[model samples]
Target: MSDLIFYTNPMSRGRVARWMLEEVGAPYETVVLDYGTTMKGPDYLAINPMGKVPAIVHNGRAVTEGAAIVAYLAEAFPEAGLAPTAAERANYYRWMFFAAGPLEAVTADKALGVAPTADQQRMVGYGSLDHVVDALEGAVKANPYIAGDRFTAADVFVGSHIAWGMQFGTLPQRDAFDAYVARIMGREAAARAREIDDALMPQPVS
Candidate 1:
């Protein structure tokens, strides 16, 4: 039996974990959960009290949150080269937390039409949605990946956000962002993970 057990609903942020797992090349058993009853059921809740998808149990330890899971797997499978060295780890952690924090918060606020005013923006973590977006654009423009030239687990988390943002108009478009996403999408592991999740998506009634 594989040491890692992944509990996820393919339609959710579990997609990010799935992509990270594929990149790690670790053998894992997937326990798929349904949206309503299944995800809220006792068994899964025992695993994640928040009733969230994309939680993974590795060596009897449960890990939730997409960015954390991605980072965990990178360190667990050091051979994958998805984790950055000590010198570069700060940047890696910087963008990962940036994605999970300010960027996520601002984008969510924007989507819900609860945008912060100029004064509120200054007091907020992201400063403003535009500032967050511009910062990300400048980072990726400077290097092919979030941590630097080398691809790391940070990209899996941040790049996914960037990809979805660009696709859904949640983020502004830029040539550097476009090329960066194209490169991330080009990975065979990413392709496989997406194909698997696409198949998992619910189909129309016959």
Candidate 2:
């Protein structure tokens, strides 16, 4: 067994982690778990009490959450050049967390039809979905990549959100978003990740 073990369900946000793994070009074993069964079983629970997919155990240390996994792998395998340099650190961490926190929350709330009122908006981190969307738009429009000139692990996290958001209709189809997605998704690593996950997705019965 490799020192790195990846636990994921292809249909889940695990794809984000999978993409990062591909970018890192590391040899890791994949463990696919089914919902309500192996995913929630005590064995897996020990690894992640949240019973979530896309958890990684590298050198015997466990890391969970898609964004964290992306960041972790970048640092763990620095030769991949995915980790941000000193100059790119600010934008890298900023937009990465923005997508993980506000962008993810607002989109989920929107999908579930759970809109916050004006008074409640102040308490919510996202404030409003439009605000989050506009912020993301500006972030992508400001640079070729999220961190600046080069693609960082931040792109893996933020780009996954943008790509998935556009695909599922959670985010609007703006020209800037369209162009950004096209640019990042065109990466060879991104294509490899999609092919792997797409093959793993459940197929319909004949």
Candidate 3:
């Protein structure tokens, strides 16, 4: 039996996990949850009580949250070489958590019609919108990728966030983001993931 089972809605954050699955070259079956239907179904809800997408089952265990899923897949498929080395552990965990924490906060705040004032933004952990962007800029500038010259599973998580932000206009498309995304999107695994998910988007109502 395949060791992985992935539940997702193509239109949601599932796309990010799909990218990570591809990065690790992990073999898995994808059960596409129907909107307003499968996600709320008892069978699906049991897998993720929050009714969220991008949840995975590996080795008979379930994992949720985009960052957690990415991290899990990296370790689960170590042969793929998608995780950071011992020396890069700090950066690996740092950027992965940042993507899930601060980035999520900014995206949620923007979505909830709660734009922060300059002062309020300063008091926030992310500091300011520009600060977040600048930090990302410097991280990529210092290394060929987020965790250094190597591409790790952290990139799959963090880079996916950058790619989505740039595409949706939520995050500014600066040169660093542009170059970093270009490098990530060029990966063979990422390309395969995009092709599969893109082709399966929004299946017809039956």
lDDT values for all models: 0.90, 0.94, 0.86
Best by TM-score: 2
Q: Where's the lowest-lDDT run of ten residues in candidate 2?
A: 160-169
Give the per-residue lDDT of model 3 (tens digit) for 76-160.
8889888779888889999889989888788667667777887887766776667777877788788888888799988988898
Q: Candidates 1 and 3: which is better by lDDT? A: 1
- TM per candidate: 0.96, 0.98, 0.92
Cand. 1 Cα-lDDT: 0.90
Model 2 clash pairs are: none
Tell how far residue 136 is off in model 3, in angstroms.
1.3
Q: Where does candidate 3 stray beyond 4 Å?
A: 122-124, 203-206
Cα TM-score of candidate 2? 0.98
**Model 3 TM-score, all chains together:** 0.92
Give the alpha carbon lDDT tens digit for every residue of 1-206 in model 1. 56999988877889999999999998999888988888999988998999989899999899999988999999999999999998779889999999999888888787788877888877788998878988998888878888988889999999999998887778888998999999898898899999989998889999
Q: Any residue pairs clashing in model 3, and if so which? A: 82-153
Give the runs in model 1 whose Cα sits over 4 Å from its true position.
Answer: none
